[model samples]
Target: MTAADWHARAAAITPRTELFIDGGFQPAASGERFDTVDPATGRVIAAVARGDAEDVDRAVRAARRAFERGDWSLAAPAERKRVLLAVADGIRSHADELALLDSIDGGKLITATRQVDVPGSAAILQWYAEATDKLYGQVAPVASPDLAIITREPLGVVGAVVPWNYPLETAIWKIAPALAAGNSVVLKPAEESPLSALRLAEIASAAGLPDGVLNVVTGFGVEAGAALGLHPDVDVIAFTGSTAVGSRFLEYASRGSIRPVWLECGGKSANLVFDDADDLDAVADAVIGGIFGCAGQVCSANSRLLVQRGILDGLTERVLERAAALTVGDPLDEATRMGPLVSARQRDRVAAHIASGRDEAELLLGGDALPGDGFFLAPTVFGSVPDDARIMREEIFGPVLAIAAFDTEEEAVARANASEYGLAASVFTSSIRRAQRVAPALRAGTVSVNTVDALDVTTPFGGVKQSGFGRDLSLHALDNYTALKTTWFAGA
Candidate 1:
């Protein structure tokens, strides 16, 4: 659609603003609501239900009751698969509506939400649905007539806390696998972007999911998120957000029932460029996309650029030239490649990072907010950055790229792996031997040899160190929501 058509559609949209518990939408227990502002226009789009501990408790109880009733947990694998496939189909059918909700609620580019986030979420759900019946139990070899059977069973009542960045995609990453394994779920979407998840609950119900099988609660992290983490009935808690909040979830889990907590947190990932890189221009393009894509809100955002001292100047110039030409404006506009930050508060946080970056390194390109009604910040680039600089060490989580120079491959690897986060990293080189050698040397969950943040649903996605643990995609993710039970037969 053209920009005018998109703008018209956006204007006509009315997002869901209530908490989705069990099979229907309802107001919060406290009857209080908070406004979710549109970052692009600085207007209140909707006043969403303000869920707190009581609301969370009610949702968890619903999930637990549904699990105990065996409406989903005891369904035949084929039946479960059929229902999940229907859910996937439902998501596809409502793609535009879902995409619009995310774009307006989260300040994501409309094109991205329509083309990438919604489609990817549907595909991920379908992939998990197709894998449902393929999962099998194992038979352990035993002596004589004795038999041993090892079967994986669903962990009932999973609590999923997803971040605002890529809201639907990340929620599907958790929800699909958890549901595929026959577990009931209580989803808590970020307060900033709750509309889509609330609508997703409606879609799932219409797709033949049993009542209370999937629920959505929206509120701030300290209230709703803490309740989920500390709920004794919650068998597992899966979360994606900042490291500080991940730590708080850990504490909450520890203080309560000690449920299994899987976290995918922040990162300051580095992209290494050696002089032997085959295409400098292509590498520069990758650098731009790696850091500035989604305004650098990605968890695996390659915010740090480490280039060999010989080619640093050339590569930095190429990246800056491209960063300057990017169009930043309203998300609903098709021509805008970069939208505003998720909120004015986030823009201010990013501004703080840029201010500190100016003190720590040379501001090579844009570092100021644009003059507009929306919360817009120009893509920033920093050069001659030190290893210990705050911008280099911390996750700015914005369109900020810090460039540093290294003399050798050893130093590059050392510098890249120095962060507390081990989420993702990238390396660019023409030599096969160096690519193979350096990839394993870097301390990260995923290392892209010549690409940045390369990933697929077929491969596992997660990180080590403070970035947290537990896989999120592929067959491995099922392990996070299920546990193996061994049964022994004395005389089979």
Candidate 2:
């Protein structure tokens, strides 16, 4: 079907949503409520259920009970795989609707939301589904004649606080793996953009997920998110958001010494372009798409560009020409290449960073707003940004690209390593020697050469330093929601 058909199908989703606790939709026990705003138009999207500590307690109770007594954790691994694969199919079946909801609420381009996000989300669920049956524990080599077996078990109830930019997909990024590892979850989706996540529960239930196995709580972060993180019954907390918020989660998780929290936080990643790069045009395309594609809302955004000094002038000029040509408009428009920032507050924050760019860095290109009713910032580029400037050091989190020049290979590595964040970095180099030599030295969890933001669902994604710890995606992610127990018996 065509785009308009997809939009109509997506718009038909129920706007009035409530907390998904246990098996069905219900209001908060305390009667609390809140309004969810549309980021694109600054209009009220829906009045959603607002969960407080009591709501959290109820949700946690449901999740804990389900994990401890339900058929989910005790099911054969193959059965779990079947459920998860069906969940994947469910996601794919509703792909058109989910993509449109994401596009409208999160201010992402429909092309990306439909082509990349939804399909990728389904693929992730499927991969985890297949992997559920494949995961194997080991037997210990003990000194005694006793038999020993190491078993991996679900960590009871899990709490996941997902971000607004990638609500549906990121939710699955955490939920699918956690469920595949056999844990029930209470997902707290960002209040600004939770439509797709709410809709997904129907699809998930249709996929055969047992009641209370998956739940969604919609409310402000300080209330719902904090309660979920600090809930006494929660066995593990998995979160994806900012460094500041992540720190609070770590603190809350530590409140219960019995359980550990797994965090995936911020990033100020680097994309280094060398003089010997083979595909300058392709590298430029990747660079632009990396930072501006999602309005720089990604945790692994290549916000910093380290270009070799030799080709700096020529490359900057070419990149600027392309940046100027980027189409910024309403997210619903098929011709609109770039959409608005997620919120007005985010737009103002980006504008402030742009205001400071003139005094702190060499302003190369667009740094103003696109004339519109939406939160649109011009695709901005700054050259020769000093390391200490706010525009360079902090996460601008908008469609702003800060470029720096380095003379030597060692200098590039040094410059890239200076950030307190180490989530991801990319290198554009033609030579195999450069790729081999440089990839290891980069101090990030994920590194790509001749590509930008290229990630596989099967590989791990996370960060170091202030970017937070633990991992998301892959089997490593499964470890976040599972615990191992050892059994031993003397002489068989």
Candidate 3:
């Protein structure tokens, strides 16, 4: 659809103004509400129910009841798979609408929502649904008279706190796996982009999910998120957002029942390009996409570039030329390659980082915000950045790249590994030896060879150190939602 058509359609679907609980939309107990604005236009789209501790209590009660009654938890694996697949189908049918909601609410390119986010969300649901029935138990070896078996059981209730960037996809990343493991979930989507998540609740209900199996509370993180994190009834909390907030979740877990918390937080990942790399042009393209893709909002974004000193100048020039060619404008425009940041506040924050960059590093390319209506900023790059520069060490979460040069493999690995965050790292080289050597030495949960930010549904994704713990995708993710149980019986 054209940009105008997409905007018109988005306007036509009056935004949902209620909280989703027990499989239905309802007003908050306190009757409080907050306006959700379109980040691209700074216009209020809807007055969503402002969920507080009271609302979280209600949602938790609903989830707990559903789990205790075995309405969904005790259901057959095939039945759960059928319902989840149906929900996936619902998402596919409403792809355009969902994509529009995400684009406007989060200021992401509508084309990306259509081509990447929405479809990826559906595929994740389907992948987990198919794996539900395939989950297997183990029979332990023992003496002839004794038999031991180990099996996995769903945690009673799961609380999922998703962030604004790729809200729908990240929400499903938690929700799909929790449900497939036969657990009722309480989803607290980011307050900035709650519309699509509310829509997903409706679709899941229509897809025949049991009432109370999946509930959503829309409100500020301090209110709803903290309550979910501290609620004793919640057996597990899966959160994806900033590192500071991830720490809060840990604190809440400690203050509550000490339930396991799965956190996927921030990153300042490094992208290393060696002198022996076969394709400088391709490496340049990957470097641009690493930081520019998703407006550099991704947690695993390769924001730090560690280039070999010999080829640093040539690659940096190529990257600058490509960055200048990128089209930046309204998110709904199909021709637009880059869109505004999620909000004016985020844009200002990025601008401040750029200002600091001016003093700390050599400004190699764009650094200022573009002249426009929305929160637009030119893709920025900084060269000769000191190892201790704030722009190099911090998570900018914008289209800002910090380039540093190193002479040897040891220096490259040392610079890449020297960070408080170790979420993701990439090495570009044709040598199998370097790929094997560097991938393991990076200290990141995910390391890509000859690629950057490359992820799939079947592969585990997460971080190490302060970037948070636990996997998000793949069958391994089920470990966060399910508990292992051992049973033994002796034959007389």
Candidate 4:
């Protein structure tokens, strides 16, 4: 469809405005509402239900009831698998509507939401669904007449708090595995992008999910998210966001029943290009996609670029050329490669980082916002950034890149691993020896060789250190939602 076609469709969309609790749509108990705006045009899309502690209590109580009543939490594995697969099918059928919701509510590029985000979410659900019945239990090799069975069981009443960056996709990342494990869930989507999540709850309900099995509470983090974290009955809390907020969940867990908390937090990842790299052009392309894709809002974005001094000048020019050629405009336009930041507040945060870059490093590219109703910013690049420069150390979560040069392999590895975060890193080089050598040396949860942030459902995704622990994708992610239980039988 053309740009005009997309805009017209967006205009015609009547966003769902209520919270999803107990498998039905409802308003906050306080009767309060908050405006959700389209960052693309800075226009109010709809007034969403503003859930607080009272609403969270209702959702959690519903989830607890569903779990204890065996409505979903005690269902057969094959039955759960069927429902999850059907939910995946539901998502696929409403691809365009889901894509449009994210674009208008969160300023995600419509093309990305349609192609990558929506499809990726469905694929994740299907992957977990397929694995649901395949999980196995272990029988202990005990002496005659005595037997021990060790099995993985679901943790009940999971509270999932997801960020707004990849709203639907991230929500599915947390819920699919939780649901597949036969656990009831209460999902708290970021207030900035609650539309798609609310829609998803409806889709799941239509797909045969039991009422109260998958509830969604929409509101500010301080209210809804905090309540979910602190609730005594929640068996687990799975969160993805900033380090500061992740720490808050830790504290909340400590104060309560001390339930398992899985956190996937912030990152300031580094990308290294050695002098022996075979393809400078390919490396430059990866660099652009690494930091500029999603307007650099990704938690695992490679915002810090480390280049060997020999090829520093050459690669920097190539990256700058690509940055200059990028088109920044309306998110609904298929041709637009980058969209606006999620909000005016985020734009200002990024702008503050750029301002610090100007004072601490040599500006090689853009550092200004585009003139439009949207919250767009020109991609910015800084060179010769000091090791201590705030831009190099902090996550400037915008289209900003910090370039630093190193003299040797050891220096590159050292500089890359210098950050407190160990979420992800990348190494672009042609030599097998260097690739093997440097990838292992990098202190990141996932390292990409000759690429950037390369990950799939087949592999685990997460980080170490301040980036937080616990895995997100792959079969290992199921570990977060399950616990090992050993049942013993003795014959007298």
Across 113-211, the per-residue lDDT of candidate 1 in tens digits comes to: 999999999999999999999989999988969889999999999999999989999999999999999999999999888989998999999999999
RMSD of 1: 0.9
CA lDDT for candidate 2 = 0.86
Per-model C-alpha lDDT, please? 0.92, 0.86, 0.93, 0.94
How would you encode candidate 3's per-residue C-alpha lDDT over 1-492 as one tens digit per residue? 788998888778876779999989999998999988776677888899999999999999999999999969999999999999999999999999999899989988998999999999999999999999998999998888889999999999999999999989999999999999999999999998899999999999999999999999999999999999999999999999999999999999889897999999999999999999999999999998899987888899999999999999999999999999998888898988888888888999999999999999999888988886678899999999999999999999999999999999999999898999999999998899999988999989999999998899999999999899879999999999999999999979
lDDT of 4 at 216: 96
Give model 4's TM-score versus the native structure: 0.99
- Regions more than 4 Å wrong, model 1: none
Q: What is the lDDT of candidate 1?
A: 0.92
Task: Kindly list the per-residue Cα lDDT of model 4 for residues 161-239, writing each as its tens digit.
Answer: 9999999999999999999999999999999999999999999999999999999999999999999999999999999
Q: What are the models' TM-scores?
A: 0.99, 0.97, 0.99, 0.99
Clash totals, every prediction: 0, 0, 0, 0
Worst 10 residues of 1 by lDDT: 2-11
